[model samples]
Target: MPTASGSRARGASDEEPLRPAFDGPLARRPAALVARLRQRAVPSHWSSWSGVVSFGCLLVLVVTGLLLALLYDPSGALVRYGGSYSLLRGVEMSRAFASTLHLSFDVSGGLLLRQAHHWAALVLPASLILQLATTFFTGAFRRPRQWSWVLLVGVLGLALVSGWSGYALPDDTLSGTGLRIVQGVTLGLPLVGTGLSWLLFGGELPGTVIPRLYVLHLAAPVLLVLLVVARARSALRHGPVQFPGPGRTEDDVVGFPAWPTAAVRAAGLLVSTVGLLVLMGATLVVSPVWRYGPSSPGHAFAGSQPDWYTAFLDGALRLVPPGWEVVWLGRTWTLAVLVPLAVIGTSSLVLASYPFLESRVTGDRRDHRLLDRPRDVPTRTALGVAGVTVYVVLWAAGSADLVATQFRVSFEGVIWTLRAALLVGPLVAGLVTRQVCATLRAADRDRVDHGVESGRILRSPDGGYEEPRDALGAAQRWTLTRAAAPAARPSPPGSGADARRG
Candidate 1:
């Protein structure tokens, strides 16, 4: 044991030499990625329910849209020979349109897919509405998030336009009618109107217009998705809109950690997606399939409805003067059509840029804590509601013929009635909305200043249960100084003495 070799062997054994084993080729990349996801995706303060829903809806829209895209034809060539002709004159179901029919009739679940696409399209706007409404109610769009709000409004506009593009792609008589409306609107512009219309049609009116629209319709949503990505980046830049508080401290917030909650949200999204697929399956059973017949220029669909999203546009067209024409620069333009476009475009632009304007007007640069109670902000809410009413009335205008036929009134008579309604309805609705808001504001103040109606029916001769109103959301609880900051709290007299007494 004391010999050199013996000592060396003993030392080696005692030292616990390295073991031979396979450290081969980096133990799988999937495990590494999963580890990274676990580390990065799970964060302390990032989870949103509304955002998740919107995202899910958008995903559905994209998937269904792609399927539709495969079946849809984006051509302007259509034949219209119902009987006794070469059967090639009116709008024929283009490559895309024919494919759509094939998808509906030929494919196993084709019709189901169509319904899914439609439902997804519908859900897209709904999600946007809810998301916007939630943010508006929560005051999440107050400061840093204002730009994102603008982007969102733009997204809504683009989404609507994209939906229109999709609607037109079917190339049915109803969509053909809708295309003519678009043509009229574009051509009705003051300058380069005809040029724009031509470009839209890829040549002349109603010719390659369907194809042009189809291309744009496919392209627009892609741009919107990119915009969404950019807007999401803004959320990172400005920090997400958080719950209101006295300060940006951790204690005031109530949110789950990002990962698990996000996973939960994903589950909800999946369930919604599955539900949409189910609904689509049901709707394809007997959709407005016949309404979009092969193709015919001679026979007009009695009252062809555009996709539901475009009901408003249909309504607008129906209200416009049937024969009113504008003579401009040696060209007769339809003012009825032009006016609506002007109104829609201007209104959209105004709305898109409104948040910045409002902030500038009020000089509000700080984060807002309280939610905006619609009642407390009467004028603005009223104005918005009035605008919506105006839009709806115009949308109903598109169905003027249907109305005329239904009510046995002349088309001209219905049109004139619509014109009157457009002028008067918004004013009345605005006044009413404002008055209602004012009343609610008064009630809110009374309740906040005084205690709520509580206490039981004490039978104090009056025999009334004094059920009181509860405190409002934090924002609504304060007196609404609409065009100004709220009044500062009055300093207590002899504050030091009061403090000592306390």
Candidate 2:
């Protein structure tokens, strides 16, 4: 062999040298992680930020929630509040409510963190809704990404239930009233309703419900985190969906690397989200339990309203006409509650199975890497618009009482109008949205086939005036032409004879 230094130099030049395993104490792990991250494929900018923001918000929520949980009590035992608030200095209240007040008014930095937690909870659902709508309108839930959509819906449902349970944990008059309504609705089901109510409340109303709800609220987030991880992993495996453009293909991914570029972008977003949450927490007052007294069975809460997420159900309850209950064999069947419950349940079921339903209807089972323009899929886009219209109308109807009081209109009139809108609005929206989609599709076809009008008058050979036309670029042409083509249905396996005949 040559001299040791010469041999080492030759090896470094001729072949790749091995990376140092232990540069310093505990250095290998970080270096390896950085290398791995650098190779990770990430989606384009617009599609990546929603998930980053959602993750950041959820992290903040978890940290703040865990800290707050250490100071919370879910029991119904009596206690006296002697905190900073002068109004409730010596008032006797339930332990749950008293602890909530103490957390809000007594502990250092507790109030700010608690409010931030609440804001994060609200942001979580909003982010999920935006992400869901993006996926739905972009047709990203097809083929390899089916599980991603299912996981997202599951996470959203769990998040809503967790928020509802957290709301009930305060044990204030408002929350207590909401809990009572929940109990009543749970008990109003036909067959398994009574058993389900018993399972929830133990024996009857107010039977060890708070502790159970507390456990659920705590556990729900962990499950959501797991589901989110699964969703992300599936996306990584299947690769991100793309829009048709130049130098783009179904087999190749075109985007930024995950290490320095994407990671830095996510880090910036995390910092900004935390800063915004802090600013909001420091100023905004949410769920002021002090204003509402402790839970009292004898008192009735006037103007009782659920949170915005639960308002649709509240609106449904409000819009239902009274005296719709039927009593049979010592059991009561409340049509007002049961019918709404049925409608919501059916809607949720349809929503969860929508990807499969769409696939069967369209007979398109091919793996799609490019997204279809909304106008290309007119019927599906129209259905999405109609669904959103129905949801918004119902959400507005939930605030019927407030609307009536503010506008000096009859509450009955508002309810009746909302009921009619709830029925007619979706139908009209579907029709209008379908027409708009068709119009857009037609315009796209015209632009792709013939050039767009340039608004310049040109003299023809016969002395007639005509407008000049501008040709579309390659990328625009590709987007519209590819989308205009009908989806290719996948052939069944073992169809070689049929293929040959064709």
Best by TM-score: 2
Prediction 1 global C-alpha lDDT? 0.63
**What would you estimate as the lDDT of candidate 2?**
0.81
lDDT of 1 at 11: 38
Q: In order, what lDDT does every prediction score?
A: 0.63, 0.81
RMSD of model 2, in Å?
6.6
Off by over 4 Å in 2: 1-41, 202-205, 327-331, 453-467, 486-502
**Candidate 1 per-residue lDDT over residues 386-475, each given as its tens digit:** 877887787787677788899998988888887898999999999998888777767655666674666533444566545554554444
What TM-score, over all chains together, does every model reach? 0.75, 0.88
lDDT of 2 by residue, 110-170 (tens): 8998889888888888888888888888898999788789899998898899889888888
RMSD to the hidden true structure, all candidates:
9.7, 6.6
